[model samples]
Target: MIRQTGATLTGSREKVLQAAAEMIAEDMGTNLSVRAVAARAGVSTGSLRFHFPTQRELREAVLRRIYGRLVSDDPILDRSVPPRDRLVSCLRQVLAPAGVGAEARRTWTRAYEAFLVPEPTEQVRDAYLAYEREGLRRMEYWLTVLADEGALPRGDHTRAVHFLRTVLNGLSLERAMPADDQILKTETETLFTAVDAVLGPATT
Candidate 1:
């Protein structure tokens, strides 16, 4: 559902998105300002608005890039692994401890924060809905694949995915903030147990 916003875009439209991505890469600042993105794109703020039509759309582009980097290297996309393992790998991608997956977990937290911030533009509001919808779609798709392969049972996958995602979002926020190892581990266990409850055992 999060198709490339760049696809089928016009000249200035694509340029603006590229510019926004670069600006975000240079600095994913707390402001997430449209004026800054428009400036970097070398377009007038009006032109940027014409192309994106809203701060939310521009923010969506930027948010997309932020998450793109984090999930790009996920083990779920690794074709060599079996389907069941790959599914578990996707779950673990978020629940990862303070080691190899720590950076990604941090990025996930940032992405969620980006989502939480209010947007003045209605276009941005719609874009935020799109973001949430696409996320849910992909999560459900993962569950569908496992169920088709007889690794997971068929049920209300949407609700199940929602439960898992809600838990992950909570974990992301808590992990992103300063917290004791004990608290993080408690939540981490909660996350794992919740996932296991949804999908059953990873081995099965």
Candidate 2:
């Protein structure tokens, strides 16, 4: 009986975290009080506090959950596919919306906006730095995979990673805007051309 009760408690905590993540993603700077999260999760504020004692703790938890989801669902690290295809898949995943929901867009926009801000707690800055490092690491991994498959040259993989990261960052910023299809197409093509110059032919 005690074990079953504990399981239920765990599930409730998860619900709170999920609710907080959805809310934070929608509005990073928006008020995410314990009461607000508890209300959204259909739990009492006391229960939410039991799971996350402070607002900062709850916000950090939400950010960690978001990062975990990104890592798990990332298409770039798939090893079964050809390197070029895997790279393309990874690029597309980053460029395209993760989902078609308004909540998803809001969450993504909020996260991006947070990263842009320079004034935040040390913890927040560290979290942003961690995210940036992970991005670079992923780029390096992709470059190594491509080189192993003879898709890219076997020299200076780090430089290639840096270039790709720069291009990706620029593309991401541009795509985040409320642009039309033609503009998106043109920007994407321009980015692709630059990528091809560094990585060789992107086509298989």
Candidate 3:
């Protein structure tokens, strides 16, 4: 067990968030606190505060850390690629298991469970809301870009974004539930097929 008294303070922001995320990802955020997170990050509480001033801020940061790949990285949005292809890449990452990369799907499973509790702290509830909001914003941004390129059929961007997200979430749950590999593959194809039906093929 690492002692807090021996805590190190040279941690980077990304390192601190990564440590906090791992801690929560393993134990469902019950171990989330400045002292605990700092200890895991090898930093003192004061140092953690230097990076994130409030506990709420720290929790929010952890949420972002978990979803950062979806929020920050886009490998297929280049103009050189077909807009449909780019959109498919975006959807794959957005719906990929948190476990698909370095994370465990259980991490996100706990998050979703938390969202359904009878009651939650305002901060916790807001964290969930902010997460979904950020995802939708990213989806909308991509859809708008595709629309501007005449890749998608003319339609309501808001409705399109919402519908696509709903479909993605449902399909994600199928695999996230530990569905059979073949079922997962089939559902994934269904997802792309639905996308094509809604967005139509890329235009000239």
Candidate with best TM-score: 3
C-alpha lDDT of candidate 1 relative to the true structure: 0.63
Model 1, residue 103: C-alpha shift (Å): 9.9
User: Each prediction's Cα lDDT score?
Assistant: 0.63, 0.67, 0.68
C-alpha RMSD of each candidate structure in angstroms: 7.0, 6.0, 6.2
Runs of candidate 2 with Cα error greater than 4 angstroms are: 1-85, 98-109, 117-121, 154-156
**lDDT per residue as tens, model 1, 16-56:** 77876675555343343667766766766766776677666
**Model 2 over residues 32-84: C-alpha lDDT tens digits?**
67788899999888778888888767766676677556655765556676555
Comparison by TM-score, 1 against 2, better one: 1
- Residue 114, model 2: lDDT of 74
Candidate 1 Cα RMSD (Å):
7.0
TM-score per candidate, chains pooled: 0.57, 0.55, 0.66
List where candidate 3 sits over 4 angstroms from the true fold: 1-10, 28-31, 55-57, 69-73, 98-113, 147-158, 176-182, 202-204
Clashing pairs in 3: 99-103
